[model samples]
Target: MALSVVDLYRDILPKTNCGDCGFPTCLAFAGMVVSEKHPIDGCPHLAPEVVERCNQELAEQYAAGKWTKRDLAEDALTWAKERSASMNLSDLPGRIGGELLDTDSGKALKLPYFGGHVIISEGDITRADDRELTRWEKVFIYNHLSQGGSRMPIGKWKGFEEFPNTVSKIKTMAGHVEAPLVDRFHGRLAELVDAAKRIGGMEMTGKAHSADAAFFFRPFLRVPVMLLFWDEDPADGFGATAKLLFDETVIEHLDIESIVFLSERLRQLLCDAADEAPQKGNT
Candidate 1:
């Protein structure tokens, strides 16, 4: 079996939590190395032979297609399909607020969504209008199916820190999801709104929060997320800030890891849209 990053790191590193790698701990350094943010040789404690072996193992795993995202997605899909095979497709609509419809292919669960209607049946997902499902959509649907929760959304919103076991990940979540958004569209509220609309996000008004802008996006049938932004105030010396809020029931539909994945995907979509927009003085 191919070793996981943790496994590889544990096998090669001294496991001493040494700060010699310029990180607070060796584990932190290992994480950076796995993410390709740091070179393997950055750990001065590692001997030449250990570094050579670690590099060789990484290369072998890559050659064997063990660490590819596609491979992981396929594995997750397979596991989800197995779990879904025993589920009652008819009951999912009531549980998750979707509609059961008879299609030419067969009966499928349809959920009206931002981009299009998402149709799910027997572990497969497709657009209701016969369009292709994006990769992110497929993964999201699979995770939704695998989780198989019966609770309905209560319309109560909470930040990631409030989710189960997510208090420790709040910083990571903010860095990955909110920071990038603030960096890309800090003062450009109109452009951000336009990008959000292109991705099927709806502007929400009259919310309790004193945000400069707020929008709602439904990434899945029952998973509603809210994005709020606070522009910088030079007089007050407050920097631009962005935050993501999830319905309290979000944990029922998808795990925290998958939630992070969706957030990152959202950030990517907004950034890509921003990049494609016409620049000043450009045709």
Candidate 2:
């Protein structure tokens, strides 16, 4: 079988967004390569042996007409479906922190989310309110189905840097997720708190750090995230800062990329909520 462009790209590149490849992110560079706009050599960090192997794989895939990116999500969903199909529905509730319920179609697992309840059965996903699941939501479900474990959250929190294989992604995570929040809500604790609460976040008290505000978000059943923000103090010369933490088991539920995606999405959600909130001077 021909290898996927995503798989091949992952194998060839250094997975670092060094910007020497002329793209903001390595994933963007991979897209360009898959579309044939750039060659694999565009990435300067690849070792010689890896480059040769990737070129060989890319050649075979091109010859086989499997160089398209259109079916990447579908392929991932199919893979997750296959994994879920082999598991017993009854056991999923305990394993994935979901609640199993009987539906007209059959047994299904219901996991709560910020938007609504997500129903999963045999690797298929649907919303409890009869709405269609978004592409990101589907991806989250696929990841949960494949990576979720039977363990529960132990209440211990660690930052993204603490997660396994995530050191290289720390810069991206901070730039995309934490910086945006700090930029938007700096010194606006009330607005930040309101936004967090609107998005199903709970305020955490008595933290050891000097964080002005801390909120916990559960974007998925098994994925718990904690965000802390420290307001800027000009007199003290301390600029505003934000830090996001997750359970140690988070790595077992989603890859670093997916976790980053979730954080960015949460940032957007908070920004939207802040915009809709009533201002002090507004009517």
Residues 163-217 of candidate 2 have per-residue lDDT tens digits of: 7788888999989888999899887878888889988898884455557888888
Error of 1 at 1 (Å): 16
Deviating ranges (above 4 Å) for candidate 1: 1-70, 129-136, 276-283
Rate residue 198 of model 1 by lDDT: 77
Each model's total of backbone clashes = 0, 0
Q: What tens-digit string does per-residue lDDT give for candidate 1 at 179-283?
A: 999998877777787778778888884576788878888877678889898888789999989889999989888878778877887887777776787643311
**What is the TM-score of each predicted model, taking all chains together?**
0.67, 0.69
The lDDT of model 2 is 0.77
Q: Supply candidate 1's per-residue lDDT for 140.
A: 64
RMSD of each: 9.1, 10.4
Q: Which candidate comes out best when scored by lDDT?
A: 2
Candidate 2 lDDT trough over 10 residues, lowest sum: 1-10
